[model samples]
Target chain A: MGGMKKLINEPADVVSEALRGMGAAHPDRLKVDLENRIVYRKDAPRAGKVGLISGGGSGHEPMHGGFVGLGMLDAACAGEVFTSPVPDQMMAATKAVDTGAGVLHIVKNYTGDVMNFEMAAELAAADAGTEVLSVVTDDDVAVQDSLYTAGRRGVGVTVLLEKIVGAAAEEGRPLQEVADLAKRVNDNGRSMGMALTSCTVPAAGKPTFELAENEMELGIGIHGEPGRQRLPLAPAKEIAAMLVDPVLGDLPYQQGDSVIAFVNGMGGTPLLELYLMYNEVQQLLDRAGITVARSLVGNYITSLEMAGCSVTLLKVDDELVRLWDAPVNTPGLRWNA
Target chain B: MGVENFTNWLRDAASTLHENAAYLTELDSAIGDADHGSNMDRGFAAVVAVLDEVSFESVDELMKKAGMTLVSKVGGASGPLYGTFFLRFGTALAGAEITPATVGEALKAGVGGILARGKAELGDKTMYDAWAPALDAYDDAVAGGADLGGALAAAAEAAAKGRDATTPLVARKGRASYLGERSAGHQDPGATSTTLLLESAARTLA
Candidate 1:
């Protein structure tokens, strides 16, 4: 557990201070509105482009927030740790970024994120008369029981969806088309995670759950919730299999499918371990006869200081591969931009 | 009761939630992401701030503002569920006489909004578990010719009982449902907070 070892000035100011730092760090590509806790592209409301906005809790740093920039999100809303952004913030962001091409809201399928985005869409449409479309991503294989009303969570696939769908939006696609692409990206992807240590929310100032030295939690989410099952710690190869097997089974990626593989680090993990895990993931996919079209391995989406990793596999066509390889300039992820 | 009393209820709920924030969060930590306490505490605090800044002419205005505050300040399923509760509760009280029967009606309206918004049934192990029994108890007490205070007390008691009853049930809604059977042992934090608010209303609203 991190206890009070976090490099923060105060627990309450963590989100605000971090937002300030991001604004300072990315002045060229991003313009962060501190008042509303929104991060926007430096030159936003691009006249004829369909706007893309996605946000959730704040602790999943470099996610919805850091992904805001050219060829990605136009704006991102930041909420409290593990809490969804309120409607007012989202509504404001929706209004600010609408350029008559309308806006597409990429929402995670969590209860809070759904409701907040729902309310914001209503307010933006009713109050501001801005057309907004929303696509909810719920691809976590951990919540396999579709009958469960809470639904599968949005995990690493969210990062991939934002990038791929952002390219479509930047290509001047209409709101409905962009939203459809977002949904398609969601439908073709699946994720599963495990944690070696619990994440401590700075506000909570303690680990969410306790796990002994040899135990690892399986089926964890990015919100700092303890995983569904606890098992003894294993080597990198075995852990990668635990994550990859469910994702492959749920999407049921066939023997000849091509996938954009993502092995995400849960904040506290090192890049070295992430690469090792990615290596294992590649080997598993090779044996399963699934082709890896592209791969991303890093702390892209994360829980705060939870030493873990989640694997996301997106079944992709040529279009998705091109979009994934598109030019993007954001604080957290950028390539050839 | 007048709008002043309703205003005081929000204030009282804020203070109570602030005091029990840690305990409520601990309860959530068991089956949830451990945020209900801070979320509720921040929400009620925002409500209290609104109450400090503006005076309401009717219970509708007061409660609607509080609902919006909670919705804007608290950012989870609780924001929409509880926010709709207060919103419908206040909307039901519009231009109506404030009596035991009307208040009970307003409570029902509010809980109905929660049911509609949350899409949760009686035994889903959510705050609805507490609110379902609380509504029935309030109406039963009101029908038995109880005063406002008496009926509210009965509702508070029923809410407490319902909160306790959530301990052994599997959660079927919200984040807790992700735990499945693992969610059975821990008490629902939303239920506990709902009980606390009802107890506050019982103590102050009358």
Candidate 2:
């Protein structure tokens, strides 16, 4: 009762109800497989195009599901809040979206997500002869290896990779080329996130973790797993620096590097603070002699009502930039053709 | 032991998980997403519902149904891990009568499936921490000519000890590992639930 109030009815119905709302809101653009908990583009399995699929927990809005459209994902599997989707859901999505060109899976590097996707890919291959390739995004620099105990988590960079690679798939790239592009984006991008507040899972009906008003968790994953270090809250500039420094250093972005700078809000933060953080992030990049070729500032990938922001820096060449500017029509992200 | 005893073991497990759901959630709240308790409880409730509605011809059918239910209903990592455990365990006993040796082999298959699914080694501070030791103890007891109940009791004790041992170890897998050093001192929720599973087996399977 002492946590942030969410506007959900029965805790068990949260994901299904939200999907229902999404389907109602975008019937022309999206298709919801209610039983399997998959979100598909209305025109999926585009005859000669490579199918791109991605999914994870439900709390992160505008992520795997919201990114499904003409130039993004063909399908997304939704798990319960903050839990990885099961293999069956992934298999259904894979088979539903696969054109003759085969399918590509954009997986985040969480253990459950990776395992489930692997199983689904195997099932898809053995059952239907659907050729599937997968790329795992692990960009968070908070904990290289920590308690949610795998490799570094896939964080903000996932949003950018989806966009860039989605464009490639939309252009009728082969499954191998699309898979390679997705992996390149993951390798060139680095991200770091911090949380000012913890989000609540609907079924749990309470905050997953408690944080003091003055304290913040740095290097948080999308699931509200405790970050690498918790420290006293700082100003937007310092926080931006805290996030940017590790990202810039880890990848060692060169002074003349052209990059896409993404500032993402963890669901609860407002646009006003996000812009302020973006301003600080820009200034830091300028000082480091990095040119921001493209910038996306919004709540594209988010934790459920957790108040914080993550910064992703992806080094891009001409081709990547061109793909970034391509048309994308989805509920979460849209651009003119 | 017979099919009735196997069914009782599952029923006891469901009840035990229901009783300890909050405790499991509390442990998860420390380092995980805080749904382990609720997820397991819902899955077992579904399993029990299925158990009541249908009369099974064999223990394998009952367990496979329970596994399928967990996979569909739980909707998390636990769903697949627990689901795979039951599916493999039941498959190992397919069309065969449940004997003390078969029970041990079934448990071995189940634990092996969990290890394959979750990919955790010993000391990773996961449910494997409990399951590995429990499996060893069960095998040791059976090898020493212990009865079914005696071996199960030994397995339960070892699992409890393994659950306790999770504290103070750095997590190398699962959600809890995200905390690094901070993860130590909090018992793993998966390990706790696994202990409940073994305890239920000890209490009713014989």
Candidate 3:
């Protein structure tokens, strides 16, 4: 098979070089810890304010690391391509970003991430007396067997949670309140993903997983895992039906219930396709009688350069809607703040 | 285990990771995202660098420093998992010369630390696959009157077998677990590196 195409100069240096690029690009807002592989806001640990930190594997750009700035994560630890960051990096991040107001870790519910973040929180508590609270996001509806596989993969809602919770932290909310808000976002959201093609990790110099040109995987995870079902290629409207049906079915979203509909691209997909998918998604929600309160369409959480998309719908209330509208400044999502 | 021996083992482990990083990444490429080798290599090199700066009066101090270095330097899952193993293991040792009996206790503590942190059981298809059997092998060897070196060697062998065994099992945890049954047919990179760690311990401590 032919090698996968990448925008990077060298596959081996993707993570480190990307950090350098990000540092050079966003000098004022962020600082990259080359040795520790952490990205922290320039003004970190705002005194007596809760610190929010999140991270996961690389390849999903503008995620945990890119979102580190004002009204977002205090620190973002970058792991290798699609792998969870280790404990020490997390510990340092927790310590670095803590300013007597305590620290909160926003972990996506991958097993390694949960485990490593848990260890880091413990170490921070034992060593520095840093009060650390971890709230895990498992908003993906693709996986039903919550008893295993760390429940479900935390998908796009995590991005929304980080923003909402970050604003609360900036407003000096206590750790408990911040954590509670994070959980609310998690509970209100459900996402399902599908992939048309696989992505390549530079270090691997090959595709992480394979999908036939005419075949697509549904209910797929972000790490290029085979989905719940593999079916022949279908029209965008049909694919939208496949993706949105299960999410709606599982959540029992009633008619007139307000929600934030997010149609996310999985890296390789273009805006044209995402917009097309979004239009289809809106129609499906209309048919289901679910009211769309707010809508975001973009590649917020991606699987490298895979040709795919995931639909995340957050059942929103008045408080979350206000939080969502609040001004925020981060590399990935920038608003008035 | 003496400080020098432990440090040397760490150095050797680092070297092995650096050399076989591509191989490890290759395995991950098949079923994972392909950073296992590089992440482990980067983390361990930092660990070796720490060995020179710290003065250790006992095994606990040495292991603690190693864990700290790994946590701080390594960016990926291997760093935290291995770092926790050493930190918890060192805490269990608590400033003593490690005897076979005490080392067994230390290993058990490290394994438990991983379990508590990762929440992965036997069939989770993670680094735990290698670690669980290695601890069991260490216990069995000690009970059979094997010396520390002999027991570690047995443990290392068990770890390798366990690592290979991950190839057929469906991953029930971690990122690979996201693949469900498709995660089978590829050896787990975490388990493979874990076996190397045990091998390093056996060679250095012996």
Candidate 4:
């Protein structure tokens, strides 16, 4: 299998060691709480400001944690391998990150993530009196039964929402504004993913799931869960259609609609494949009479070293376009106005 | 169950997790990410470290300490779910001696905490699937005038059955649920591990 290979002391120690590495890599910008297994911005709990927190599993590197800086998340709770971070971690993060302005939880739509964050919110409300507002990101269109799902699985747009909503919060936007903007992003975005090969979780010391050599799983989630269906591997254009078509078809991105198109790699896939897929996706969008206002092509959110990609389209307005262009600095992505 | 028996049960449970840490992760690999065993091992290790420091004057104190330890050490869904279980259990047993009826009450409190925390119904293909039925069986066993060990053993058996039932379920919650239909045909690692916990209770408390 041409998949992820990592160097670590043991499968069990990856998260803790990674947190330690993060602390060492960016001491000025980040703080690692070994006790709580949480990553925090060094100067967090910025007085009188709404603290933003998000987290899930460990493989989606530079996400919830790496985004913990200026104009992004204030703290992120790290869970086991691909499991959602528990309520205690969220509660700890919420309390540590809270100021007088309340705290916001940017949760992906997964049962575990939602439930854990909910419990944290309850604890924060009862014990600490910390005002907590949670916005769930469910941009993935792959999962059909929304009622059966813990809702939709939050995918690529989460990274975008974190940035946009983080900016709003940084500008001292009220909790309600930041929350509403997050909801707006959720309402306007849709995503679909595919897996070329399975990802090997370090702790598992093996792949959690499998994929055949000639086939790929469609509508895959970040955890290497098999998608809506499996199909023979095809050309990048066909694959892009497989991904973008569902997202666009589900939402019907129409003429004159401007979108933020994101082509994200699942991890093991190279940048070369990502660029190729992005080109194909762009062509598909153009053919559908949709205009691309902003585009990002890379592995912003990943599932270990799974070989695959996902496409996310967020219909944009003037305000969202401006926020997308705003200056922000984090480990995974950076831009200056 | 007396204080000594409960303490013994707790220690044995910790040892079981420690011994089967890799086994738990192995089960996780089949259906979920492979960390349940390790997470439980880490949490219980912390519990063991502070076992001596806890005041057993009340069951609540010991359980509360265990819950906090798991929260501080374990970082995944199990941490919060199991931690909340202990926390609510402790609250239920506050200022009380350990007894079969009290144990049933604590189990109910734990199940309630899991429900409030996870929002899982009986068939969500989560640890709640095992826990909910186990609590119900524990209640039935107690009401039928079963002993503590017998009651726990019944609960453990039900949990094992519940865990086995998840093999064919379409998961509706957690990471496995994202798999949808693909999530079927795999025994839920969380539920399986939860059954182990009850089994330990049955064995140690017996």
Q: Write the per-residue lDDT of candidate 2 for residues B35-141, one digit (tens) a residue.
A: 89988998899999988989888889888888888876776678888988999999999977777789899999998998888889999999999999998999999
The 10-residue segment of model 3 chain A with minimum total lDDT is A142-151
Q: Please list the residue runs of candidate 2 whose C-alpha ends up more than 4 Å from where it truly belongs after superposition.
A: A1-4, A146-148
The lDDT for every candidate, in the order shown, is 0.92, 0.89, 0.85, 0.84
> Distance (Å) between predicted and true CA of A59, model 3?
2.0
Cα lDDT of model 3 by residue, A221-269, tens digit: 7876567678999999999998899888877688888999999999989
Judge candidate 3 at residue B85 and give its lDDT: 89
DockQ of each: 0.80, 0.64, 0.47, 0.49
Error of 1 at A310 (Å): 0.3
User: After best superposition, candidate 4 residue A318: deviation in angstroms?
Assistant: 0.5
lDDT tens per residue, model 4, A1-337: 5444688887668888889898899887888998788999888889877889999988888677888888888998898778787777888999998887888899998766776787789888999998899999998998877777677889999998998888888888878788989999988999999998887777656676677788988888888666768799898888888888789878778888999999998988999999998989989889889999999989888998889999999999999988888877677777882
**Fnat for each model:** 0.71, 0.65, 0.57, 0.53
Q: Give the CAPRI rating of model 3.
A: acceptable
Query: Which of the numbered candidates is closest to the native, going by highest DockQ?
Result: 1
lDDT per residue for candidate 1 within B3-36, as digits (tens), equals: 8899889999999999999999999999899898
Give per-residue CA lDDT, model 1, range A145-250, as digits (tens). Answer: 8576499998999999999998888889888888888989999999999999998877777889999999999998888887689999999999989999988888
TM-score winner among the candidates? 1
Report the CA-based lDDT of candidate 3 relative to the real structure: 0.85
User: Which pairs clash in model 3?
Assistant: A87-B80, A88-B71
Looking at model 4 chain A, report the run of 10 residues with the lowest lDDT sum: A203-212
CA RMSD per model (angstroms): 0.9, 1.7, 2.7, 2.5
